[model samples]
Target: MSLAVVTLKKGEGRLLKSGGMWIFDNEIASVMGSFVNGDIVLVHDFDGYPLGRGFINTNSKIVVRLLSRDENTMIDEEFFEKRVWDAWEYRKKVTDTSSCRVIFGEADFIPGFVVDKFSDVLVVQSLALGIDRYKEMLVELLKKVLAEDGIQIRGVYERSDVKVRKQEGMEPYKGFIGEEFSTLVEIVENGVKYQVDVKDGQKTGFFLDQKYNRLAIQKLCKNARVLDCFTHTGSFALNAGYAGAKEVTGVDASQLAVDQATANAALNGLSDTVKFICEDVFDLLPALEEKGEKYDVVILDPPAFTKSRSSIKNAVKGYREINLRAMKLVKDGGFLATCSCSHFMDYELFTQTIGQAAKNVHKRLRQVEYRTQAPDHPILWSADESYYLKFYIFQVCSDR
Candidate 1:
């Protein structure tokens, strides 16, 4: 039995008993026997009974992130294959999706790791030291998992560019494991098609998490002039154009994304009414207001301003500022579809932020709908920490 010593409170063992993974430093009763970072440890309650075993990182606030309970389940090639295969099997049943989260740590019973499948290609992110150490088996398991599913081998691209890699002591790694392709990927979302950039695009090439929200905004854009702000790939604009929007404009800071959006617009033959602007979204709003520009529908889906605990307050301010400026450009009785991708800031904080912005502008706001990540990113009930992305569809009201 992989044994060291870490202590938990009297009743605190309950969560661990229920297969919970996290063990905060403060929750520890004490540590006995020296355990280096990422070494396996045997956890116990006050009574000194074996609770479970998992990897321990004394340096992290999360002192321990449990990997497995049973000692017999060796942390070897077979161990990774079992978990990877299980995650793959679950996704196949749940998703009719072309792009999906093949592994959602903890929810899929494997913490500190995640894998997203974009058609035949796989993107793996190792978020924990325990799982990060198992990279060899993990990759091997992926290959075997693909073989089992009969997906022809392409290559596994490791997009470990996320800041989470810092905790795992891993450097940023991205690129194709095998032959890379020059062309973009073709994926369908809610009957609308998109070409996703596998290598350089954001968050595993596209915000697949926001797949449903884009479609919801699409339904409201019919016969209306739509403005999609911070529009990476012009998803909202393109969807609106496809759903019968009169005209659509997508604004972003990146010329690359603007060009990608333009190419995407051409793909669907909607370039006639669709326009892409490579300019700052913040700057464009006031200029649009000055030019007496207005849109029947507005979408404000910006990149997350807050990525850590310290930046949450600033992120809220940024959210409010953007929403306030955006609300001013919306036509009376027009809809504003906004979203927050920062999981550190909860929905309550975001809603209140937007609510205050609306009040300051003296605009009546009615929430038309709420949206979250598509079904592929399932929330584990035992641990409700899974919910991250939130979208709000609101209608602004003036004298009209």
Candidate 2:
């Protein structure tokens, strides 16, 4: 059967031409041939030049997500098996495979779908309708690929309940992909153990992208007082305790998070030195400032303050305020670890915001190092969304 042809409007596919996978709704000039949404279609330039093959969906602003740049490539079982094999091999080389992102959406060349491995289990999230149809096949293929390495996947779960699915004209969904199993799964990273709730916890149960960033702060925490703000599940605080920090206090507004963090502290046998508090970080930071409490190391790992371009101004203010307060809480010559997970908050803008915060507090920052999301979450150039995390470590010094 002949495939449908989608031709782009003149000068409208700049992003796609620049190695991006998406063709926005306004970029296409015409669709020739009959096909349903999610069917693979041939894409062409305005001059009738063959571009590639991609799945089309009029329901999304991102109308087409390219699957193969080779015009002759077939989108069959063989094609998907290679994609799975390649993604798995890349992770084994760059990150610890026990628990890590196996496929990172567009970065791994599988647009709008993500698969994360947690111990012997798999969690899949599909955000695009075009990819949604292939979710089960990809999951099965992933299992087959992992089994090649002698790894047995015990269960597969789906966490496609994100709001973005609505944009694709699909309803949110969550449940087991295969046979039901215990939803509570434990995984270790940087020597810290966590109980991941795959059924109900936030965004695939845990934030694995910060795996290395959490490890980076351990050297600075030994025998020092540490404060971890927005310490969800106590990953950083426990790392500090594991490093022999004199005292560690982790604060978060969610009582459930605080409870889990406290349990994790006990799980690591650090309950004596590490503690958790349930309170608003924004409110608690000011009260702690008033109390004149200081710490040798302060870590701020707040959730993304913005998810869209329109709210970037407010996100800037939020990042600046939290950073300024956290800096004040750090004693002179002490360490500070801060990060922003919002991709909309670009590197330049985030750095400028932190600099403004330091200036406002009369603190001079000596750069320690800068990092981004873990290697498993590879950042594909031209697809800026893949590079969301920006982490920085610094030595906070009092101005003379």
Candidate 3:
């Protein structure tokens, strides 16, 4: 069958040309040949120069999500197997494959598909129509590749119930991909145990992107009083306890999260040192200050304040407010670890926000180190979306 062709207008596709994977609808000049959404299409520049093949979806703003830059490459099962293998191999080299992000969507050259391996269980999120069609095949291929290394995958869970699926002309869905087993799976990271609920927890149960970032905070926590905000599952707070923190108080808005975090603390035998509170960090921060509370180390890992560019202005205000409060609660010459997971926040803006917060609180920030997501979640340079996490560890000193 003849392939559909999508030709870009002259001087368009600057992002694709610069190594990005998405081709927006606004960039295309015309489409020729018969094809339905999610079908593979050949893309060409204005001069008829072959750009490559990608999955097309007229229903979405991202008209084409490039699968390969090589026009000859087929988007077949064998091709997908190779892609999965490459992603797995890369993770094995950079991180522990037993619990790490296997396929990071566009960063792994497989757009809109993310597979995270948590021990013998795999959690898959298929967010695009083109990739969703091949989800089953991809899971099978992943299981097979892992089996080759004697890693037996007990079950696969699909967490594609995100609103992004709706934009791709697909319904949101969630459940076991194969035979249903215990949704609660245990995995150890940085010597701390966690029960990852693949079925109902937020965004694939646990935040695997901060694997090393959690470890980074542990070093500064030894024998210190620590405050962890937005303590999802108590990863950082538990790490602080494991690092010999004298006291650790974790705060989160969700009761479910607090309960899970408390269980995780007990599982690791750190309950005595680490305790979780179900309260809004915004309210708790000021309340703690009013109570004359202060800590040696304050860690903030709040959720993404803004998912879209339009809300960035409001998001910055939220970020600044929390950072300002956290800084105020830190003891003089204490450390503050803050991060923004929103891609729209960007590095420069996040840093500037923190600076503004320090200035407002009459504190001088002495930078210790700046970090991003763990290596498993590789940041593709050209794809701005791939680099979402920005973590900073600072020593806050009273300016007075």
Candidate 4:
């Protein structure tokens, strides 16, 4: 069967040529042959040089998401199995496979689809129509690949209920992919146990991307007072407790999150040392400052302040405000761990914002270390969107 061909305009396809998988609508010069949206299509340069094969969708600005650099490559079960196998092998080499992100969208060379494993359960999120069609096959392949390593998957759940699906001309969906099982799954990370609510919890239950980051805080928390803001499910706070912190306080705005976090603390036998509070971090930080309360370690793991470029100014202000407040609450020579998970807020911008916050608060920050998301979520260079997380640890000291 002949495949539809899409030709890119001259001087366009720069990103695609530079190892990125996306080919935007504006980059196309012309199209030949008939093809339906979400169908595999051939991509070519303006002069008719064959580029590769990708799934095309006119509904999205990202018109084409390349699947392979070889135009003649078959898009079948065998093809997908290889993708799944490679992703799993990479994870085994770099991260603990007990529970981690199995596929990280474009970074894993499978764009607009994400699969995160929580113990024996797998949560799949398909954001683009092209990948949505193959979600079932990918899940099955993942199960097969995992079974090769003696890991049996208990169930599969779909969490494609994101607004991004609407942009792809597909309705958001959520539910079991196969047999229904308990949505609550327990998983341990860095000696901390968490009950992940795959059905109602945040994206794919818990934030596995911060697995190592949570572990990184343990050494700093021993016998120290620790404050964890935006403490989702007490991951960081519990890690601090397990590290034998004298006292730990985790703050979040959602009562549900606070409840879950509290439960996790008890699950890990850290309830006595780590306590979760249902309050806005922004509001609580200033109140804590007024009470002359200071901590030996302060952790700020706030959600992305902005998802788009337009809202970046507001995001900067939000990051600056919280960081300035957190810095002030850090006792002299105390450690501060802060991070931003927004891809739009690049590393340079986030670092500059932290610098600005320190200056405004009259604090001297001695850099300790810098980090990003865990290796399971590999950052594909030149694919800017694939890299989002930026983490920094600094020692906060009073000015002379």
Candidate 5:
């Protein structure tokens, strides 16, 4: 079948010309060829210049997700195999390939699909209509490529039960993609052990993006009283405990998370110094303040407060509130590590929010360091979505 051609309005190809991979529906001037949702179509500038080939979905605001810029490039099995291999080879150089984000959606040149390898297991999330069609092929290619490196992927699990799937005109799905093995997968990072519940845990059962950020907080935790907020499964708390912190408190609203976190602490034999509490952080923080609670190190690794651009204003308030409370809880000369995982919460805005919080609390902040997601999750330049997660380590002092 002849591929459909999608022509963009004049001046609308600037984003694509600037190396971005997304084409908004509004930018499209007209559709000359017949192609349904999830079909591979050729994109062209108003002057009929071939821009690229992408998956088209009229249902999505992101009308087209460019897969290749070359007009002659074939979007076939071999293409995916090379893309997967390239992604894997890149990970080998910059990150621990044993277990890390092997493919990060658009950043990996595979738009709307995410793949995380945990030990011998692979967890995938296919979000876009077009990418969903090639997910199985990508998985097979990934296994083949990894096998070349002598690493065996025993099973593949799909965690496609995300709300975003609905936006793509597909029902959410979850379960094993192929042979079902024990869903309980164990992965070790920075020498700490964790049992990831790939079947029913948050976002692929673990937040591997924060792998290095958690490690970055270890140096400030020795003999310090540490408080980790929104400590999903207690990754940061465990790191603090393993770093020889005097005491570590991990707070989460979900009891299941607290239970899992407690078990994780026991798994590493850090339960003696680490504890998990099930309570709303907002409510708990105020009570702790009333009790004059203070910690030598406070870590805020909250989920994305805002997913879309429209909610950035409200997200700023949420970020500022938590940061203000966290800063107040830090004793003089104490360290505070705070981060926002929302891409909508841009770097400059997040830093400004933190600065405002410090000022509101009348605290002086001595910048320690700044970091982002682990190198494994590469942030492709010009692709703003590739860059989320802003982490800052600061020493808080009393203005008085």
Candidate 6:
């Protein structure tokens, strides 16, 4: 039996008992001995009262991602599969299609792992050292479980190419489990079809998290001129065009991405209604404003603003600058669809930044429909960071 101890300070163990997972560096009183990354540990109160069992990694900021409260049982594939099945049942009740995040890290009681399903294929990304240790087991179980549900395991590609993985002393690795699938895969979301790039595209090859939020913008883009900044593959712009927008212009820094967006528009048979421009979104937005261009709806979904606390100040600056410019580009009574995926920057902080941007630009926000990750990406109360995606759709009331 694996035995170790993680001592929590006097009252800090309260959350632990209350089902709050994640033992931060400060929460631990001591290891009481040496422990390797992914070693199973028994958590205890300051007085050594038995708390629960979880995996530990001294190298990561989050020291532990607890698995169970039972000590008699062992943590293995069954333990993980049980939790995953429960999550799967919940998803089946909520979603009809196979497209969604099947397992959400802490929410599924298996921290450090996330699995997103797109039709028959599965995309997995591991962020924690402990989770990395069980990567094989989890993937095996996930593929098996998915197969039973009529989901063919097209590929098991790793998008661990993220920045956080480097901090854990891991390198970037990505490819198909056997052989790569066609980078171009057709995906249907809310009755709208999109061409996705899985091998070399963004996270999971598509931002499925914004599935519903983009649909919301579609509801408002009727007969409107729309601008989609940072339009990676033109999710927002495509939705606007499908929703009967008078016209939609997509902008991004990647020429290849712009080409994909153009192809996607044609795929949707809306090429005449949409166009793509390859350029920096910041510079392009300013030029559009200078050209006396005013849009009825503007979408600003930039990449993570802050990767760490140290970069938060600059992130705030970047978010505010772009949001302020987006506000100006919107005509009176227009809509602004904006978002931030930086977990370090809280929703309140981003809200304040956007509110300040509105004030500086003399635009009044008429309404705010704050949204988070899609139903597929469950937010385990134990881990707030897992709930990173946020959307703020508001009416840009102007003096015009």
Candidate 2 lDDT, tens digit per residue, 284-386? 9999999999999999999999999999999999999999999999999999999999999999999999999999999999999999999999999979899
Task: Write down the TM-score for model 1.
Answer: 0.90
Q: Where is model 6 more than 4 Å wrong at Cα?
A: 13-18, 32-35, 178-183
List, residue by residue over 101-162, the lDDT tens digit for candidate 4.
99999999888989999999999999998988898889989999999999999999999889
Clashing pairs in 5: none
Error of 3 at 351 (Å): 0.5
lDDT of 5 by residue, 1-400 (tens): 8999999999897778999999998899999878889999999999999998989999999999999998778999999999999999999999977679999988999999899999999999999999999988999999999999999999999999999989889999998989989999988998889999999999899999999988999999999999999999999999999999999999999999999999999999999999999999988887899899999999999999999999999999999999999998999999999999999999999999999999999999999999999988999996989999899999999998
True-vs-predicted CA distance for residue 132, candidate 6, Å: 2.0
Q: Locate the minimum summed-lDDT window of 10 residues in model 5.
A: 10-19
CA lDDT of each candidate?
0.81, 0.94, 0.95, 0.94, 0.93, 0.83
Instruction: Let me know the TM-score candidate 3 reaches against the reference structure.
Output: 0.99
lDDT of 6 by residue, 1-400 (tens): 4587888988786566777787788888888766777788888889977778888887777787787887656887888888877888888887645578888888778877888877767778898887888888888888787778877777667777787776666776776665667656687887777777777787878888888888888889999999999999988899999999999999999998898899989889999999999999878878878898899999998999787899999999999999999999999889999999889888899999999999998899977588987877777676667778879999999755
Q: Give candidate 5 regions above 4 Å deviation.
A: none
Q: How do all models score by TM-score?
A: 0.90, 0.99, 0.99, 0.99, 0.99, 0.93
Candidate 2, position 102, lDDT: 96
RMSD of each: 2.6, 0.7, 0.8, 0.7, 0.8, 2.0
Alpha-carbon runs more than 4 Å astray in model 4: none
C-alpha lDDT (0 to 100) for residue 173 of candidate 3? 94
- The Cα error of candidate 4 at residue 64, in Å, is 0.3
